[model samples]
Target: MKRIYKISVAIVTLLAGCSKSGLLDKDTKDSIDAQKFFNTATDLQVYTNGFYEMLPTYTLYTDEDSKSDNLIPLSVDARVKGARIVPPTNASTKWVWDDLRSINFFLENYQKCTDDAAKLKYGGIARFFRAYFYYEKVKTYGDVPFYNKVLSANDPDLYKGRDSRKLVMDSVLADINYAVANIPKEVKLNEITKYTALLLKARICLFEGTFRKYHSLGDHEKFLTEAAAAANELIASNAYKLFTTGGAATAYRELFARNDQDATETILARDYNTTYGRQSVGYLMTAPTAGVYGIPKDMIDSYLMKDGTRFTDQPGYQTKGFYDEMQNRDPRLTQTTAGPDFSVYKETTREPVNLSITTSGYRVIKGLPSRDQWGSLNSYNDIVIYRFAEALLVLAEAKAELGTLTQTDLDNSINKLRARAGMPNLNLAAANASPDPYLEYWYPNVDQGLNKGVILEIRRERRIELFNEGIRWDDLMRWKEGKKLEKPMVGMYFPGLGAFDFNNDGKTDVFLRTDNTTPAPAGTTSIINVNQKRLTNSTSGNFNPMYSTPCTFDEKKDYYYPVPTEDITLNPNLAQSPNW
Candidate 1:
């Protein structure tokens, strides 16, 4: 049975009493007899199973990517549109600590178990989750109040001020270190293992390291060194590798489309099986009436040509149509988005780009499963949490930022991904000798002396390889490139605006016009009103779905979200974020 099913209703009822208002307010201890519950390995395992709820579900995979430059959704997010406001209470703030309270509650009483092995195992899992919880808090609102023990409502520490980033991160590091040292070195796809803890360590350290370096916070080298070391250990373990059995054409897409998580590459995943419950990933990615998220041109432009050359280097690339642009690019591009030749199955029927489904013409097909699964709560694909490919990227980026990267590092890290995509190897010397001006324009703040160019390439690789895995926003935040959100997001291009062939099958795939009365041209599969759909230029140019939405990024105030006014009012020492 799946670990998710093992969580009992009794445990759920116990954890449900945690209050969301004050940090660590509700004490569930009075409700349950901890002495009886914390007595055996099975008991500890059952209690710890609740911690898995903290992991992300399929919603994050489909929704969070829209907040980044990778996809344009039906509606612009308030954060992306510069419309976010400080909340009156903790309602809108991500400041809830109920999960932490439960984790800490378990930690405080788990020692009653007498089983040393189970105690250490479950204890490590609790600490790992605590580290994961704090990492998210730190990423959203820096300098959060760190708590290891479950606090009573009237505890003095409940009203204390926020801890320093350095102090809190150091504590998080300690927790993760404990988790790594104690967790069993076993391969469990649905359960957290030692390697999963290591991945979390590498992820958080890399975020902190780059955030410090870009935001001018001090002590970045310590975190970068730790990040590189963690990633190195994971890679040296040889426990996982990139999923390449599907080869170039299907390897990347198959990673997400399959129902089962490929254990060879996926270290940890959120289990979604038919017996448990299904998700809406297939419906959200393919339904014509509801699927509004679309891959943007900026992300589409990031894919390198098949021969390892930059796609932007080609002449007249900007004005190229959908069919033309799809030609000779990375195989992942066609696998991820709707091209002229895209089909859901091996049958002869082709899936044309549906304008109604995607705000941008570039419909995303990365996570969509078979046609039979495109119904509400019908898909059973597991959502990946940690994979070996990310470990490799983390190691390479950490080394590059630390100015310790070499050609060997590229061959092991970025080159492996490139090879999976059927692209040539990334030559460190060539990259450093002449950086892609296109990537440099996106990340002008990357100034690592001779390693600057290679760093830019690594960033590009990270973006392309991990496009919709819910990490793009954090990447932008840590790099201090929030302003990129303000740029106009566009899709496929059109020279004039009339009937156009999306698949290059000698038949009109779509018709674009400003007038609503005129009938669509014959053989057109879809008709789009440019006035409603929008274009960068009045009559022609790239499809600009969000042209009317005003997007602004205030570098001073936007990086970290403001704390709730109510929380600050309750405890005056709990200061609001800067420039809120």
Candidate 2:
């Protein structure tokens, strides 16, 4: 895997030319001219390396889940709060296309290199990134304008309206398919490869398929079929598996904590090295004033028991205190959240869950670094972009939605992940016979008849396994469950105001009181004023993070973001999304 570093000034200048410029300025000469630069395979490699910048960095671990119910940050997200508005100008818009222009520029000029193999390799990579770029755009705003070639400032197409979703997605499909067929088969943890292309194809197809199905758009089956096929092909390749060397007790958490990417599971990742620069994931997730991200009680309730049972089915489950609730649950719950034995970097003693860091009582432990890499801009763990477990889930989900899923499919896909977690394999028949009510309640739109039970189970699996990985918001959107965001966000249960031991280690972890005038009990690590925190029952229920602030999800307009007002004004043909 190549360690991504700063690119040369020549490549930087070439990329800068793709920015907003007039017709005459578009052709202006730079330090290293584009015509002269595209002469060798090494040049192609150097130029394409810039595309990695398009991938996510530490934010993937810090607060990417804030938009979904899986996490609650100190400050609610504007989108979650239904506070999004149409920006006044393109400058304030996230709809910029300079990256697309750069990729298109490379595609147009890569033929200058006489080496056919090098051209095909780099060309495939360029198309993969272009597909990636468009996938995000399509997710954000449906029916965006699709540009294949670099447009000159005077080009008439610049004033045209948005293209049809079919046209743009079809173009994206072709680019990803070409990438899968032409990219090298070799596995590179930090570079795009055949498997990475395959993963992207599956992801794009699954999203489009589910989104179309749930949104009542036509032609949903084709995308689902393609999604299953792409995932199946990747699984059949035998190139990757779950990273289980650490065993069920530690493998899952260690996978994200390691500084290096695990070749067994990670298909592609953003490589970060201490030598280049430090990453801020540790500080962002663990610092009191930095991230302030917490796992919600609703999400915590979704994790199945160790013996493969729903935690919500147990008697008195709602009011279970922190220590009792964390007992004998899915190992992932302990791995992902700070539990009885969880300690911060370099600390031998188990740290109490600080409400100041996480507004909710649950602190996220996934992607947290060791003692040596704990401070601001000091961690360097490689953030995963694609992994084998997701591909498996995609395959299982696509098949289930298509009504072609079978027990064998479960054995091949979902069960693989369950095995790595030391949990029992999911039985298709049993799951269908008795669907989990909690899952069905959360995803009411999953009406696949007999397949509905298994589908809901798969969604639950996806939610638990992929929590805090930055995929929940898209999952909710694709499933047409945006209203879940409006549901109350709460944390650990409290019978009433009193000092208590959260980890069951005989030490008072927190004192819940009504006012500052009341002194906390001795040895209490933290004091949370229940009046300020706002419990659901006024004094005894779960911690309510949004008791004072109400959140809304507009079914009509919240699904798609509105275009910038100035862009719509500049091109009168371009129309804004409905109800913006």
Best candidate per TM-score, number?
Answer: 1
Candidate 1, superposed: residue stretches over 4 Å from native? 1-6, 9-16, 20-22, 345-348
Cα TM-score of candidate 1: 0.97
TM-score of each: 0.97, 0.96
**Residue 293 in model 1: lDDT:** 89
Clash count (model 2, backbone only): 0
lDDT of 1 by residue, 529-553 (tens): 8888888887899888888788999
Q: Write the per-residue lDDT of candidate 2 for residues 1-580, one digit (tens) a residue.
A: 4555456635744654754421112432442567787789998888888888888877887567987788888888888888888977657455777777778888988899988899999999999999999999899999988889877667887778889999999999999999999999988887889999999999999999999999999899999999999999999999998999679988898899888886799998887886777788888887887777888898899888899988999999989998899888888889898887787643668765577778788888888878778688899888888899999999999999999999999999999989888899999999999999888777888866888889999998998899888999999999999888777789989999888888786878888888987887678877988877778998798888877768899999999989887678767898898899
